[model samples]
Target: MRHRGGFRCKPGMKQGSVSLSPIPTRIVSNEEFNPPPQTQAQARVESLITSLADEASRRLGVTRRDFLRTTGGMAAALLAMNAVFGRFFDVLDIEAVEAAAFAERQGDPYFIFDVQTHYVGAHYDPADAETKRKGAVTKQALLGLRRRVREAGLNPKLGGDKGTIDDLSWENFIKEVFLDSETAVGLISTPPGPYPQEAVVPPKEMAHIRDEINRVAGSQRMLAHGLATPQLGRADLDFMEMQAGTLRVDAWKCYTGSPPKGVEHGWWMDDEKLAYPMLEKAKKLGVPRVCVHKGLPLGPVEDYNHPRDLIKAAKDFPDIAFLVYHSGFKGAASVEETFTKTGEIPWTSEFCRMKRAEPGIRNIYMELGSTFGQLVITHPLICAHLLGQIIDAFGADHVLWGTDSIWYGTPQWQIEAFRRFQIPDQLIEKHRYRPLTRELKAQIFGLNAARVFGVDVHAKRNEIPKDYVSRIRMTYLEEGPKPSHRLYGWVVG
Candidate 1:
């Protein structure tokens, strides 16, 4: 039979070369059909039916109705699969334009000051062959590291394939991630360590390295918390002071891990013999803040790495602000408890008590560096509850954002993960735990940091070009598909 579009085929035919002209008329309804002296509508319907029948006959050697039924079933099946995969689910539900407009009008403080971040000294200087070589071990660890990250609800593809010290370099570093974004400021520290195992550098060399970081931060006003290894001796302290005095560093970063015996050993925050003298020196130097590593002390010095010790120090030095890095990473334990007993644990409550007991202890801030991000992304509900408690204990103003980058890679993922939390809007508004408000975001991002460190963030902020400000969009999963299963678009550097 010949179709109305001028194609012909026989029944039961299996020809692959059959082609037909386009059907130019509108579809006809069944009611329009009639016999002799057929109207235009009737003719159109007839043409469609004939074309369908011929097409089906040519392709499947079947009747037009059969082909129509088969296609309809396939379409329905696809729709069913789409629903099962959750691809059609609208998570955010808000339109991008509406959200952007709302965010803009909120007069949200545009600048973000990341108070805690980490980078390799070698990453900024690729020519330093030694740094590059040491970085290789870090790279080798990634394959295994990525698996752990996956279990934490993060996409593994986002991590850089090659581990280079330059990945942490300030010049190449800021330009690639921080510079072009709303990240107006950053406070960087070395990756948590047992400290360098080799003999400690001479005082002069340590001072020189601190100088190099200061020079790199330059006009951008990027602040690096000078590593203070009390084990290096009075000469090292002298060198650190010169770097701090000359460079005018923002604060001091004290890694809690113990050093070699002849080197400075066991400088616990509560240890009056060790920590008190250091705090006294910081107070004398006019260093406004001190960030101390607490909890999950990765290196050989686990004995000295308790958050309570830092809490004790904070109580003693009520005048100085002490940022509790990692906020006592109770996740490793919390997760174990939950998995084993299928019940909740109260780790955050115990940690909060340490911050709450003393009056000026409100001066103590929680640096949501690696610890916060890991908990929030991996355990949203627990993180939300913990952050709420932290906010209740130490007003929201005291909570800060820290990426712990380079060692963890870009802080972008941390920011994005923060955006995804499903806490109540009221809780977000009232509680300091959710630092999403424009003013609070700005504070967490950088303003509070400026006030605490006594830096001119506004002046430094004005230095960044206008173009950079416009480009700093915090990524969200709503944007599009991510490149790797391990990486989320919101977290890419």
Candidate 2:
């Protein structure tokens, strides 16, 4: 089609020519072409739009079908874009001084609570290649070897490899990240691998694992999420109570995977056959909360960790206060629908792949442990918006901060990104992400965790020092160790 103002015409077009603007023709005399001052504003806008478009295009490669299917109308797409872009500009324009001011308002001391963290034990390191070979070949003999590999950190390539265990040592892990960063408290969970199908270890070994966890946690503001398996005999339960009641371990961590016969393993949280009894026992034990793993199945376990099962359990045991890990990722549609229909339950944005099925849903709280960095950089706006939505849905007090660290490598980057996220003052005032008041930050940072863990956060508030915010920011942004993953080549440096 031909356009007005001497624009070229295309063949076989019947419509009148559309008016077109002319391109500038002045030749640049300088080494680089500099836009006019007036155009600088336009250029900035254009640059931001272009960057946003490029990101959308990249994500579209993976989610085009979903986008097209969900956004049946162009208007809906535009609305989504407007919401996303508006937030992007807001974040980009955040002044460092404002962030510092926000940090200082809390007396520069915020109670730190890492709701999700992992610990590697001595068994994580294999003594030699013989042990490694034995672990690779024999089932029973491999239990200790696998634990060693987990402690060493699994090579993600090996389907189970995480990273080097040396990188995960409690001494190094805490010192390099938490200790120096002003971490006041942490919730530590057992690494997933130590539980074997063959149940090679006696009940004593399971108790020993709890002891090791406590030892590593030390007296420095720390709480434990005791790992449990039905495979443990009565003696094991006795030992666990001793650890929990005496040591004051906060919660019980349960895996929803099916175990092989004779091997002691945690019961699947969703398995009605096992869940009711387990819940009863947990309730009887006076355990206030249970952290259930409800996401991707690890290793040979299949169909055991579905969110639907967790939902049923939640409905059945309303008093249990179940913390569904991954927040029923596969059932996000149902979650969204549930939130839309009934304004209860909290959700997290890290599970946006599933949550996007419905926008503005609430009632599920999100933990930002494993889903930081990669998602934050790639889908900054959407992730922030989702976080906002979660805040709105659950209230900032309900949202918890976690770093599936150790497995992902220290919580530094995750913490940094959250601290750096530039949520606008207007949005904050309007409760856009459910109003992140100072009280809410305290709740998310420590109060909620303490309540869930049945600990007294107020008493330990003094344990959190001033300058912690600046310390976290500096540690994460300036002094943090770089991620070894090659995928994030640009941002690491």
Candidate 3:
């Protein structure tokens, strides 16, 4: 499951159990790094959204919750963000009150293929008290901040205040990814576990879920990743063979930053002896898309998580598509101010610069999972610059869409935010960066990924409407959609 700064939802918890802000105004971590405290700008945006919702809901004769669930509510949230954060979002005042205006602005849907999404499998033990406590406040305890919060007991009154495995169950995955969001196809990914074979959601289980979802939908709507740990050497290569032959995995997901149990250091992608063999095996197996976890440092060693190694690895294996998750973003809080001042994002900038020098490293693709979700709300200028820079550096054809969802609850808000997002003219003129036009967005959203993953988007889009998943979603919407606008991750209170 997506790490949420060491917190998990309590058992028996469901979406929409408590009030939620239409747009998240606070920083929420994916447990890769500690999320910074709510900034003054974010706090102001939150306050402004609250007041706007109150006034608008009263005028419309609906509750604040009901208003926040509509497209108009999403418009109001964007408007408040623009008011506080310097007009980065494209939203209008009329769109915030008028339903038709908001609907008109949100044009036809794009082929949304989320490449980085997750959930806990059946192996996740709920009754394990230690796991529960760890899931509740592991990161805080490690950082020595919130030990008493766990001891003080879970506040069941709040939505998802309890720590349990069921919160990230398979059912929730289907509901959130398929029914709640407009995700046409999702790539089921996994985090690095002590043993790749017995992961939280092992490759076998991931494949099983993939098969089940597509089987039920009667269409290809899911893809699975087989975990690869090159530090284990031969065993890992053998495991890759089984996954390729028996499991028939779509890609090989590797976490070069996370060392397996008993290993002193993490492995590198360019390591000829260790990682190259795995890459070679993957190429031989006919699954050449090697999705690696580059940014969002996994452990105490942040050096391992940097995206520098991928340049060489990708250069060596031009046939393999190295999908770099998080786009090697160092983290939101650390880079926002720096980016605003210098127009340079941390690891991502370095990555782009490296690629510019080479100019032939087109095999590497940038995947925006937690990176986009974090920056879009906290600092849209940085978000704009980020999108602009990547498109300029790598071209729109190489930037892929990924929303490390289920941690952020549903992927819909991220999708909506992306649909309306635009790089301002000033930033465009100053940096000579290309505008985020609809055609380019369509490429980044799904077209680029479709090419990488061998998905026939035209065929898939036509098939999705007739699938069982679509039928379920249609019925669910007919019953009055109650999206839990909740962020499952930990936020600074």
Candidate 4:
């Protein structure tokens, strides 16, 4: 876990059965950086649920579980939150049931394309994976636990390598994404390592898995990230060529935080020599959308992880789209003063301001991966500010939806939270921020990413309603909707 000798990335190759999924499971962290407060808001949600459950159950004449599944049930939950936490959600009254208000809210029509999704392979070398990697405790432990699940059908040996055995087998991912969450299309992205391909969920394997999953589903609902290591220079460039020419990657996922081996520190996006070449190659390859992993400071090169450098790159390469993952949010921060006094989030607000300063720089976009998940639970006020500020600065169409799931387990929670989340009238009126209206939410949820990634929303919209994903979900719910509400981020005590 320690970065010694100024080496940011420890080099090694990752290999296994090559199951098709998103990113490798080893990349997941279950730590809760922003645990929910136990004061008024907590008491309020509990009281609302308890009191409303009784009242709503009597009125609806249904069990708690059955009620929770209804529009009324969801409305009650939001109303309770509104009672305690102000108007953070927009929900209609229970009386709107006859009007199909609940059905309309539940039957979200947006094509949700998660720009960040990860999964580990069926197996990974133990020495390279668990021993060397950060967050190994959570990563390895979950891998061990998932192997025991009967549905995993995990081969005990997993090709007889000294590795962490996992059911990160491709099928589980499909179940989690297609059946578990409302993610219509997912762009598979991964972290980098000393040996790029050896890194968990490498580019070639991502492309292979993407093809296989789409091929299996008989639908083009998967996308792959071409891993870019600007630190590696020519080798990285060559990998880009291979990924573009053969692998046919949908976009580029760059981790300025995790530089390749032998590099003392990470490089910046505006680093004309190191970073621009990769952008140039992406442009040449015809896939100009480059997703940079910013805000989540990993390893020793924390300097490059802030996303401040992306402004220059955005201005210079107007053709290439620079998607800033995690919205430059540094985990969880107290929003009370930050939002009130400065009317800005540290890195996030700064990043948005940078975008605003250069109105012509339309290529820069903000992504909410771990950022939203942390804030939504910790404080809805923070969530409101996040949604309000980013949309206000980057525009609703520029903010993409990403859960960094399997790490957060089913993205269903985040999806439900965001769908229900609304900016309070106080914040909206005072800050003059755009309302987190349903239509705007639809754009942020998926329409934005759909356009950026070139997904045929019209075509997918028609097919998804009757697609295998929906069919399987229907049968799955009929059997019983069992959601694994697990968070894989490493929580510091």
Candidate 5:
């Protein structure tokens, strides 16, 4: 029952309300799992951010919206989080008011290459009966956040209506990912459909967007994932060849949890008889990277979505680099409690343990998409532990950056949060985890993915500033940019 509900926001549309805070204080669902209600800390953070914005706006002689649009406002949001959730973030009081001070300390220098990002084709209809039925179920799943936001007296008009499916369209995609964020390059990924053509953002459309963006940029500004469905046997393999040859996909995106029609259940990455043919085709086609959807289970059978199946497959095909999307995180609802008690982070920790056991498996990599977004806001402690554990097990070089953005509006906040996030000394000493130094964070942010994707960071960085896309962004900013401080996902209220 998965409909084509992809892109997430329409900043230009006159929604009755707008968010005053730049960062999301409550858990926001990407229509995957039901995001938990806002915790006490999140509530406090939300209130504090508003009050801080109110004071700052008055002092700066500008509207609250204008204040939040500045770098100082981003600083204020993080500063508020530190106040309520302890000192996990490194923000200065001056940063909340002085744009220069904030810019000097937290400038975007890292080569940010978001490995997982999504947006739908604009032609997709949201008003169709099929989409309405699916949208209703998604709305019900997100009710906890909706109810909580309403109860707290927050902005009721979060992301306009579900009917505004254009919020998830390609136009908004360019606005959120390119103009609004510091993302130099982004890989367009889509959810797996019953067939490749039936996906929310089909492979042909993904490649078209990629080509269009890169064409505009006049550089390698975007990459695309070709959907892989091994369960369809020869037809799937033929489709893979078409994607590799015709679409010229940079990588393959698969979902073991989502099987096509008539299939009894989901398939495994380790299945030689089924999956090996597809992998072999990819290797032959010269696209050696396979980005598999490992967590945030897409169906009723959760086990199929687990990353355990990847170990044997990765070992068997050392030439193919296996990128596990969501890093196989179980879900937002259970992460904090489970990690607190067992000192293990659900499926992610288990996957890391498996990697630890098999030191020879160097081809497997962990990606932080929706997983990092959920944990960082709700439980920074658990977020700290997860980052530590993953880095400790699979070197920082193997961890990839992915925001699952457009789903969460612009990725600037997530980028800022990660840049300022510190692994507390207690967890560092106890877990013997490497400190998240600037160099390490840089690698996780982009260097690692650059190597995997064959992106020459130095050249791209130099070229991007003069690209057509850059010119457009500069012009847009010159006219005073309006970054819809909006979360495109289902938020509380």
Candidate 6:
């Protein structure tokens, strides 16, 4: 059992034991620690865990919470999920599960390279202290849903009174990404605020954290992303030079929906005048790999953020790699109804179909950020279809594993879930999708990323053993892992 003790808790309340089962084990819904399950499926999953936990706790001689902390607890959850849903995950007997957990307690394999990760400064702004304080107030003013959430009595005190800003700090980010999860390498990306420099995370801070982590580890474990605002024109060009020349960025992270200073609405990637100028600049600067935030659309930016523009941009610039983050998921669509009615997923299917039509757009890659996390937990079949379609269209080589971590707490849960997830044979046969082979899974997991980033994986594997970070990880595991598996994103009631 993984004990929870590293961090302090509220008075009269213990630290809610959270798990992706750091053994990276799968499980039941964490309604107590996470947002309450709103739907019937979620509620059912919760009830199953409660019932199973009751029986298992009685048999194992432990409390329900204590049981939930154990390998057997995680096994019970995964087994319950498998029983309720189809056999999408692999679950073993309690003894076997405990043994497997023991092995993972030692170490996990498949060098995990997370391409999309985020962590903001405690104060996400540096402009004004008063402005930042008021900004927090303005932000809280918009959160009227918390009241509605309270009215519904569905996870009223969602994270148990822990302030939102406090949870998303540098210390927690490192623990959640590195100590708590098996992520060997990560790329730091951010959103555009005033300009790239004064972003939620400035390029300098991003680079500093990247350097500091690697320096402490004594190996290349982190990569920083430079911001690109094509609409800003020359200003953006200047920033790109600074990021590449001065900051020495690994790649460019752009948000098509976020307009630069001069532009009013925001421009698409195919726009020759606005967007292409930045792309041209990036090519000139020699940091050509462009990671664009496509989908998980916000309010005003919906139209511009769609992955449709990627077709032209990718075809136009074969030398430049275009990564479509979030895999163009429009919203949390009803996976069950979509499959039942049309046997199609909305945005992902459309993007994949686009690839089939063009056949020349090989440079555009589909990244699984929030897309994988939401679907795998909510609807595995839809998740299966989404993965199947993307892999079939982009090929296993072009599909990347990105959890959009820190926001989702640890990437460990997503990682564990993916390792256990399987594409059903019926769906595979119906759609002619590739059964996620270990070889293919390895490619998507980190090998493909290693190839993209030009990391010598074989050499790193050798070097990492003696690195400072490896030593840190060794001491950390010996001390035992205590993960605060709290969900840090906006929760829908």
lDDT of 5 by residue, 57-121 (tens): 89989998889998878998998989887898989999988878988997658889999998743
| lDDT: the better of candidates 1 and 4 | 4
**Candidate 6 or 4, higher TM-score:** 6
lDDT tens digits by residue: candidate 2, 1-493: 3222111233432211111101011111010011112123223433443444344435545332222222111112222333444543212211211334334432555666787665433243344444344324333322333344346443222234333344233343343245334456676764343342122222234334444433333224455666555445454466457646665556666656534334433355555664566666777778757776655333234355554454456556767766655443322213334455653222333333343453334334555544333334333443554567656544565567775544444454345445535556665566545544456666766677666666676656543332222233344445432222111000111
Task: State the lDDT at 85 in candidate 6.
Answer: 74
Residue range with the least summed lDDT across 10 consecutive positions in model 4:
17-26
Rank all candidate structures by their lDDT, best first, as comma-separated numbers: 5, 3, 6, 4, 1, 2
Note the Cα lDDT for every prediction shown: 0.48, 0.43, 0.79, 0.68, 0.80, 0.69
Residue range 48-111, candidate 6, lDDT tens digits: 7777878877887778776665556666776666776778876665532364663553244878
lDDT of candidate 3 over 393-418, digit per residue (tens): 78889999999877676888899889
lDDT of model 3 at residue 171? 58
TM-scores, one per candidate: 0.58, 0.53, 0.87, 0.77, 0.87, 0.80
Rank candidates by TM-score, best first. Answer: 5, 3, 6, 4, 1, 2
Model 5, residue 39: distance off in Å is 2.5
Positional deviation of 474 in candidate 3, in angstroms? 1.0
If both were scored by lDDT, which would come out higher, candidate 2 or candidate 4?
4
- Over 296-382, each residue of candidate 4 has an lDDT whose tens digit, in order, gives 666565667898899998889999999998899865545555667776666787877777888877888899998886666556787
* Model 5 regions more than 4 Å off: 1-18, 120-169
Q: Model 6 lDDT vs. the true structure?
A: 0.69
lDDT of 3: 0.79
lDDT of 1 by residue, 90-112 (tens): 12312211335324433434566
Considering lDDT, which of the candidate structures 1 and 5 is the better prediction for this target? 5
Task: Report the Cα lDDT for residue 454, model 1.
Answer: 73
Q: Number of the top candidate by lDDT? A: 5
